[model samples]
Target: MTTTHISPEFTALLQSCGLKHVAIIMDGNRRWAKQKLLPGLVGHKKGVDALRTLVRFGSDHGLQALTVFAFSTENWQRSTEEVGYLMRLFVEALSLELAELHRNNVQIRFIGELSGLPEDLRKLIQSAHTTTATNTGLNLQIATNYGGRQEITQAMQALGNDIAAGKLKPEDITEALIQSKLYTQDLPDLDLLIRTGGESRLSNYLLWQSAYAEFYVTETLWPDFSPAAFEKAVQSFAQRERRYGQ
Candidate 1:
């Protein structure tokens, strides 16, 4: 599906609302394929296409950062064949799209236990990071093998080690310090968290960063979520009043 551009008025509305960082839990790829009576892998491939469109939309719309839940740690429980196919698809997609994304000045970053990925895939991810490190357009963060709880646990562990090594005092630990240890340290906290495919739960996505994020849930599957739909979500967000804790 072709991406539809947002109107200038809507762009102005988003700016007024301070909509910058957006996170997505891209779900329902398998369900979409099942509904179409096709192999699950086909759905994943289509989801990649949707992702490409989303990245372009974010860049064109001047979004600060777009974080996508590409692959969760729990996904490792899927059938071996399906998991293998996904790994291969990641490699293929990155190889095919990295150059174009870099040319568009999108800074690509992967947040997760990247050490657990296959060596070839890790190398390609590293290459994508290095290639787009200096880009200033869109900050594209892909969470592969990531879980919010896991991320927090790792950060706490790091802090503990620092304290044990005399590099930090227990009293020095603060929210800011913990934030600095997260994978998304330098990025802005999520302003909007969207979950496609009708799921209401976060399923262990950016838990900490989404503390006060406005959520937009849709029945549209990941493969079928168009930019126009995203525009609607952001419009909905712009209509809301975020009081943080007020």
Candidate 2:
């Protein structure tokens, strides 16, 4: 099958933002699989392929950081088997692609609750992060078991506890301080947020980080999420005028 190739026009549209940070809420793997009469795991695997391609493309396309919402905190509500399969899939994907990502100068970072994952998978994620930390090309951040509310809550709790313990003063709790407390502390603020599967809501993805992000959503499920579709999103984003609450 031919993966959609990037067109000049799409690349031109992408120039509009200088797209320092782009986040994707990858959705609908199961639904896409259902449409194709394949098991959901197959769709997840295809999504991983798309992710690999996109990361390389982002590196070539000058995007500073690409944050992908892989699994939500609420995803734990899924069947145990499905969740287990996704964990295994993540391990397998990293196993197969780590060398290439490292070779291509991509920095892999995972943001989210690591404590909920299996010890082995957690180690795998940590190892990948450590291995790719020195690369300077694409910054690929995968949000696994992530929730916007949970992130904010955790940040707040940490700060509050710091104050209670006399490590911080309440007056020192600035927006930057809060930001530094979140999972994306070192990452750029979101410039664009793309959601697949036609979902309009944030679905608790990145609440604070996306306060000013330009939103682009589509009906394309993750398995069918093509480069062409991604280009379309960038085109749409390029045409927008950002006011930043002016």
Q: Write the per-residue lDDT of candidate 1 for residues 1-246, one digit (tens) a residue.
A: 224475677667668889989999999899999999999999999999999988887787788899999999999998999889999999999999898898888999999999999999999999999999999989999999999999999999999999999999999999999999999999987899999999899999999999999999999999999888888899899889998968
Candidate 2: clashing pairs of residues: none
Top candidate when judged by lDDT against the true structure: 1
Query: Which segments of candidate 1 are over 4 A away from where they belong?
Result: 1-6
Lowest lDDT 10-residue stretch of candidate 2 = 1-10
TM for candidate 2 is 0.93
Candidate 1 versus the native: TM-score? Answer: 0.96
Count of backbone collisions within predicted model 2: 0
Give candidate 1's error at residue 102 in angstroms. Answer: 0.8
